[model samples]
Target chain A: MQRYFIDTAMTAAPGTTVTLTGEIAHHIVRVMRMAPKDKVELVFPHQQAYVAELTQTTPTVAARLIAQLSFNSELPVAVTIACGLSKKDKADWIVQKGTELGAQAFVFFASTYAIAKWDPKKQVKKLERLQKIARDAARQSHRLVVPEVRYQKNVTALCQLPKDQGVVAYEEAAKAGETAQLVQVTQQLKPGQRVIGVFGPEGGFAPQEVTQLNAAGFTTVGLGPRILRAETAPMYYLSALSTILELQTPVVQSAYSE
Target chain B: MQRYFIDTAMTAAPGTTVTLTGEIAHHIVRVMRMAPKDKVELVFPHQQAYVAELTQTTPTVAARLIAQLSFNSELPVAVTIACGLSKKDKADWIVQKGTELGAQAFVFFASTYAIAKWDPKKQVKKLERLQKIARDAARQSHRLVVPEVRYQKNVTALCQLPKDQGVVAYEEAAKAGETAQLVQVTQQLKPGQRVIGVFGPEGGFAPQEVTQLNAAGFTTVGLGPRILRAETAPMYYLSALSTILELQTPVVQSAYSE
Candidate 1:
């Protein structure tokens, strides 16, 4: 079934007719050509998903709620991927893949050794584009929520953001054979906690930058022994996190359970 | 410091001058512009890494072996990422990212639902390009070995390839709440074992294809609840494997140890 995220909430009970307007309505009525009785998923605000059957498609695209979906695909813990500004297409790649991998948000900041700088004039446009990518990826992945994309002026600005825990993916940590920090951090994560992971650019973090992060309460950690490129580190982190938090624990019985 | 993978083995003892030629030499001389006494790491055929000091940069780029490196970045278990062929740039993206994530090798095969088909005439050139990407990524990630990229005609060809164990990422498994198989398989993996992970294309595998793999001793596993792109699945598998096989165990003291 096709899924669409709607801006408004569906407060009425099941069997109530809900009309979709704007882009989503055009997509359903014109692009998908969904007709009466065709089932589609409508995700409303607050991450509620419902299965709705199309009732009227001629004058407007509308559907009546069948039932709510119970299977939640979101990560148990919310992760904000904070990365140093990098060169072209990397940020876009990160947002798209990160959303698919269950990140709750993404933050790009200029660090001491960052090679790319977001132009003040073009920052909004770039962020909007990234946000769109995240939404598309989220929809494709059947995620109820789209991860937000944000920009921080510098490392200090990134540090000011609130998170339950913060860890910086420092190359020096990996080079120094620091292997336990990342696993240790993940082990400490509890459900619903928000954690931020900081990563560097192609030219990794400077010594002083790492120091500042350390002073600001971010633990320096290594993803592994191998040198992951700037963009690869976050994916590794998210994957490892999901493995540890989701797969390793006792199975959560949900609608998908046999 | 720079790293290069050399074609020939260096059997000479320390202090003996070894000459480098071809692309490696040109990269060290023209690209890096190194002078005498500069240090570089040269990896040999059997994954031997040695630090060498430049003897001369003139006639040929020559260096004297300074010492041998004992730190191995390769995963404890060899992982071959077998992916159903995807559309343009996805294969390239998978090869590069998979190399950094410590996949031992890559195999692209035509599955029942694969949208992209490799032209027989263009296959070799495409493989070469992917192999180059693996090499560059290996160098960038300070890997001891470059992962070999291969093409298989179909699922049977992929299954016929030797591996101690195999797991296929199945969307149905995830939807059916099959989460234990992957972690169970990872837990069962022993050091030095070879494991292969299979992923579907954008269109995903047909039901019969999954059955065929299951008959071939490939256990179906879920990466997570969220639907990951075909290329992203391999990265998740590799990263999760590394986390389970490398980070969860006791840290091995290496050269960087204090």
Candidate 2:
């Protein structure tokens, strides 16, 4: 069954019919050629999923909520990826993959070395396109909610975003073999805490920009020793978070002590 | 300074000169527009990096080897990524990002659900192009050597590849919350041992294909809860390995026990 993220938070009790409209209706009817009796999964605004059975297919599409599904695909700690605006394709790639990897939101800002300049005239259109990519990716990945995408004019504006914890993926930290800060921050993270990680553009962050990030409470951390590309670093950081938070088993010291 | 991977096992002893030919020569002379006395790094077949100064830029580029630099960027354990052949661009993305993340080799085999079929005539050309992508990525990431790229006709050939340990990134394992195998395998990995990981294509591995991998000594391992795209899974696995082997500090259980 195909999955779609619905915008309105309507009750999906077992007997209620939900009508699909706008682009989603067209997608189901024309692109997918879905007919009455076909099945689809609709994700509600509050991040709950329910199976739906199509009841009507002409002119518009409608489905009845069959059952509610359980399982939170979202990460325990919400992560917002803040990147210095990169090339167009790189930005799109980050949004798509970041959503699949369980990012809560994505924020892009213009850094000192950002090669791709954001046009003030086209900002809304560009942001909308990126948001669409996130929605589609979230659907494909079976994520409960679509990650919010936003753009900022510069790093100063980016620093204002609220997060319980902030970290920066700095290449110099990798060079200096500074690995403890990430571990410290991630270990201190509790479920539902918001972490915002900022990465530099292809040219990386300038010294003054790093200072600003430091002043704003973002600790610089290394991904690893290898020189990851500007685009690759964020993925590395996100994966690290998942490994530490989700995958690793807790250390039971008694066994080791013996 | 720029870095170039040289094929021949040439000595880069101090005061000795090495000549660049073919594509690498053109890249230095034409693309990079190098002048005499400019510095460049040369990586030989032995995986040693040397700082060299341009001695000649005409006919064929020549450089004088100044000193041998001694830092190995290769992972403690070698990793080979075996993926079911996916769409053309996805396969390329895997190779490029996998190289940057420290994959020692890449093997693409056709799974039962693989949508892309490799043409016998174009295999060599395609493999070469992917190999070039890995080489460029290796140089950019300051890796010691380029990862080897290979094509296999089916999963059977992939099973025949020798490895110390084999693991599959099975989606079902994630659903079952099977998190121990990857940690177990990576923990027991000794330095220089080879580990091969197999990932499915867009449609994923069929039951019979999974059985085939199991028979070949591959242990299925889950990445995490959220779904990962075919290209993204291998990078996640590699990053996990790096986090375990390179990034994390060993737990001091004795101190905690007290």
Candidate 3:
């Protein structure tokens, strides 16, 4: 069944009728052409998911809630992928793929060696485009939450964000043979903890940028021995996190099983 | 420093001269615009990487071997990513990214639900293009080996490929909440073992296909709960392998450290 993220809060009680309007209604009525009694998932605020059967498709689109869903696809620990702004569609690619891979949020910041500069005039438009991509990817991946996309002016501003732990992906660290930090840090994380992983652009981070992040309490770590591209690093980080946190754990009643 | 995979076997001892011609020479001379005495890393056929300095740049390009490097960037276990042929540039994307993530080989096979079809006349040319992509990605990522790209006619042909272990990435297995197989299989893998991971296309596999693979001694594994696109699943698999095999192990002298 197709899933939609409903923006508003709805009663959690079963058998309640929920009406969807605007883009959601248009998608259900025109795009999907879902008929009465057809089932679709509606995820409300606070990550509550439900199975709902369509009651009407013409004039208005509405569905009657069936039962609350028990399984969640969100990562056990929330991850914020903070990267230096990159050129062209690289950011777009990152957001789309990152959402599917289970990142809780994304942050793009300016750095000394970053090739792409975000224009002040068009920054909102650019962010809106990325936000839309995240939404679409989240829906396609059956995720209950759409990751928020944000921008910071520079590395200092990025460092100000609150996180339980922060790790900067420095090539020099990898080059120096610092292979244990990533595994060490990820292994210690408990459920509900937030982590921010900082990555560089095509040209990589300037030495001082790494120093500043280090001063601000970010540990320097390497993804692996092979040098991953700027965009590829984040995917590697997320995948590693999933492997460590999710796949390595004992089996549970998962989202898909429901 | 840049790296190139030299196709032929060369003298591994230092203080020897290696000649470069054709595309590799063109890239070093014309694209990089290197002068005499500039250093570059040349990887020989047996995965021996050596630091060499340019001797001439005119009618011929030659380099004198400086020293033999001890670091190895290839994954501890050789991994072959076998995916159902996807449409457009998805295969190209997979080969490039997968190579960087440390896949030793890639195989694209025709499957029941695959939308893309490869013409027999153009198959060889298509493999050449993917092979080139793997080479470029391997060089960019400083890998010692360029992953071989191959094509299989069907699932049976894919299963017949030699491997110490075979895993089929099934969404149904994920949906059924079978999450322990991937970790169990990967945890038992010893260094130098060969493993093949098979993935489906956008439409996924037919029931019979899964049964066929299961009967062939391929274990069904779930990557994670979230749904990954046809192109994205291979990356996830490779990244997970790197995480479990490389990051989770005790620290040692790594390739980048050299």
Candidate 4:
């Protein structure tokens, strides 16, 4: 079944029908060519996924909620990857793969060493495309929620976001063989807490930027011994957190029961 | 300093000169526009990095090995990523990023659900491009060894590769909430042991393919709750393995002591 993230809250209870209008309706009628009686997974604002059948597809697409699905595919800890604005394709790659890896949000900020400069006039279109990629990736990955994607004008703006813990992926830390910083931080995080990890551009964060981040209470952590590229570092952080919380802890026991 | 992988065994001892010829020599002379006294890191067959100064850049490039560096960036366990053939760009992405993440080798095999078919006639050119990507990525990441890239005709050929342990990243295992299989397999691997991880194509493995892999002694493992794409799955596996064997185990204490 095809999946779409409905913008509205869950208004249709089981056995009730709801109308999906605007862009989503056009996507179903035009792109997907879906018709009446076709099935789709409709994820609502509450992150609840419901199997819905297309009741009508003419003027507007409508579907009746059949059953509520019971699965939590979100990570135990919500991860926000705050990366310095990289080149065009690299940012797109980060958004797509980060969503698939269960990231909750993505924040792109301009650091001193940022090579790609975003145009304010085209920012809307750029953000829309990135958000669409996140939605598609979330749907492809069967994620309960589509990660929120946004842009920060500078690192100063990024430092203002509210987060439980903030950390920077510093290559210097890796060079210093600082292995325990990330492990120690992730170990102390309880379920439902939020963590924001910052990464640099290809030229890397400047000394003043690092000082500002450290002053803003961001702990520096190393991914490993090898130097990961700008886009690869965020995915590495998400994977490590997943290994620590999801694999090591074993969230659900059904598979292990055997 | 710029880095280049010299294609011969380490011939010169410390404080000795080595001749660089062929493509590497061409790259150094023409592409890099290097002159005498330029510094470069020379990675040899022994997988050791040596700081070498350019002694000659005329007809052939020659450099004097100044000192033998003492850093080992290779993964504790050698991982070979055997993936089902994907689209051209995705396969390229996997090889580039996987090299940076410390994969020993890459094997692309045709699977039951493979969307991309490899032509035997073009195999040489394709393999050369991928190998070049791995080499460039290895140099950029300052790695000792450039991962070897190869192609396999089918899944049976992939199964015949000698490996201490084999695992498959199965989406079904993730759906069943199988979280501990990969962790268990990675935990039991001693240092320097070879592990091969198989991944599926866009449509994933067929039921018979799964059975075949299981019968061939490949343990099916889940990469957490959310789904990963064909290219993303292998990087996730590599990242998790690095986190386990590198960060958690504390491979080198020199960088940590400061």
Candidate 3 segments exceeding 4 Å error: A249-258, B249-258
Reference contacts preserved by each model: 0.59, 0.48, 0.53, 0.60
What is the DockQ of the complex in model 2? 0.45
Docking class of 4: acceptable
- The Cα error of candidate 2 at residue A19, in Å, is 1.8
Clashing pairs in 3: none
TM-score of each: 0.95, 0.95, 0.95, 0.94
Candidate 3 per-residue C-alpha lDDT over A1-258 given as tens digits, one digit per residue, 9 for 90 to 100: 889999987676689999889888988988998899999999998999999999998788889999988877888888999999998689999998999999999999999999999999999999999999999999999897899999999999988999988999998877776788887788777888899999999999999999999999899998889999999999999998888777754334222112
Model 2: per-residue Cα lDDT at residue B112? 88
Report, for every candidate in turn, its global Cα lDDT versus the true structure.
Answer: 0.88, 0.87, 0.88, 0.88
Docking class of 3: acceptable
Choose the strongest candidate by TM-score.
Answer: 3
Across A1-258, the per-residue lDDT of candidate 2 in tens digits comes to 699988997877887899999988988998999999999999988887999999999867899999998867878888999999899999999999888888989999998888898899999999999999999999888899799999988889989988899999888888787766776677778788899999999999998999999999999998877899988998988887887677755353222112
RMSD of each: 5.1, 2.7, 5.0, 4.4
